[model samples]
Target: MSASLAPECNEVKERYDSCFLKWYSEKFLRGTARSDECDPLFKQYEQCLSKALKAKGIDNMLKEAREDNRENDAEHMRPKR
Candidate 1:
């Protein structure tokens, strides 16, 4: 019943999170480019973010994710350690 649904929902959330992390990592490497070669990965990342937004009940999560991505990019662009 409700308990079963809870675990199933959690699995979905975890999957979405993992997908987002993978996408973000790749996107960070891709930087500001919009090349067709990066399209598939971007689309996958969008799909995962969308799923995560739905599960988390937050409509603006995508924007936040993008912002976070930008910050991460900036951090990486800095001089290496």
Candidate 2:
């Protein structure tokens, strides 16, 4: 329904979003989904998105965001004892 981060990947993203929503609501929510029905569509969208992120030089940012940060978690956020 919304535009993708990469305009070029919008169509693929839309297809993946639609299939994912349908599968999630009609099958997953109802406990009838044998597996994700949108895997292929999602994969296609992911590929397009990856290329776009790399083109825009934000792939590393995303990679960093996805990494676990517990080891480097800020002590300032911890409650004082």
Candidate 3:
């Protein structure tokens, strides 16, 4: 079965996407000036993303999902309640 079709793989993919979105929002997306302050967090995010994608070989798909999440976050700050 494809990685996306596996429950565990799908969950890891979702978690990675969420991690990237949260990092992007806090570091770049939000109208804040870029600074070294967020570098550590970004590094951690990159590590996590790498690990997740390595497990499933779906880095490109995860990246696209992260972009979509960012756009959605920009449109609506708080996730639906």
Candidate 4:
């Protein structure tokens, strides 16, 4: 649940986390399915995380890991000859 590469953006991340908890309990658990309640906070958190990831040089690493995961998935799904 933590984001922004750890210590950075902790406050905004916590704010988003709180909103998520409220939304989860009030909407999701209540079977309302309302999704927009925490979107703004998530956007803010994501924006901050994007910057932090770029600053910490982790974005490219994550992209490469995702690519590797995709390759692994493809390999696992290969049809038998």
Candidate 5:
């Protein structure tokens, strides 16, 4: 885990990061972008982070970052015409 912004989520982030790195190497690098493998763990980590962010009154920052991420992903995934 790369040091979570919210200290409270550090442990959750570490677990999720480990799962993600394993999945990334075994699945993603092997030619798949599937997320089902880590969906539950990711959701758990997200929940932890969300609570921390909300508590610190930084949920809006989190929302903006999520929006930016979604937009970037969408742009990259869009069909080239």
Candidate 6:
């Protein structure tokens, strides 16, 4: 997998990635995943990533991007002319 945006978060991200892969392949694809098996790992990874994004002033940009995409989602769902 690719490294995280922040070098400091890379380790946590890797741990999360590994857990996600195992859960996805072993339980998710098999239709046996009862709950989010990677939630804790994901939370840790998200915390690290969020800190990195805030440090680099990218959190706002990402938030804006998400808002922009949300606004466009409805438009995109309509039949094309």
Which candidate number has the best lDDT? Answer: 6
Q: In order, what is each prediction's RMSD in angstroms?
A: 8.7, 6.5, 9.8, 5.8, 3.0, 4.1
Instruction: Give candidate 2 regions above 4 Å deviation.
Output: 68-81
lDDT by residue for model 1 (1-81), tens: 112223434544555566556655776566843544545555655565566557777757667888779978888889997
Which candidate would rank higher by TM-score, 3 or 4? Answer: 4
Summarize candidate 5's per-residue lDDT along 1-81 as a digit string, tens digits.
Answer: 489988878888898899889988888989877556888888988998888778888988878898779878988898898
Error of 2 at 34 (Å): 0.6
Pairs of colliding residues, candidate 6: none
Tens digits of lDDT, candidate 4, 1-81: 654455777888999998889888888988997557889988988888898788889999999899879978888798878
Give the total clashing residue pairs for model 4. Answer: 0
Candidate 4 to truth, TM: 0.68
Residue 40 deviation, candidate 4, in Å?
0.5
Cα lDDT of model 2 by residue, 1-81, tens digit: 899989989999999989988998999999999977799999999999999889999988877775757555675567789
CA lDDT, candidate 5, residue 21: 92
- Tell me the TM-score of model 2: 0.77
Global local distance difference test of model 3? 0.63
Please rank every candidate by TM-score, starting with the best: 6, 2, 5, 4, 3, 1
- Model 4 global lDDT (CA atoms, 0 to 1): 0.83
Model 6, 1-81: lDDT tens digits are: 998878988998899999999999999999999999899989988988898888899989998899879868887889997
Cα displacement (angstroms), candidate 5, residue 38, comes to 1.3
Per-candidate TM-score against the hidden true structure: 0.31, 0.77, 0.32, 0.68, 0.71, 0.81
Worst 10 residues of 4 by lDDT: 1-10
Question: Which wins on TM-score, candidate 1 or candidate 4?
Answer: 4
Q: Considering summed lDDT, which 10 consecutive residues are worst modelled in model 2?
A: 68-77
Error of 6 at 81 (Å): 24
lDDT of each: 0.58, 0.87, 0.63, 0.83, 0.84, 0.90
**Predicted structure 2: lDDT:** 0.87
For candidate 2, the C-alpha RMSD (Å) to the true structure equals 6.5
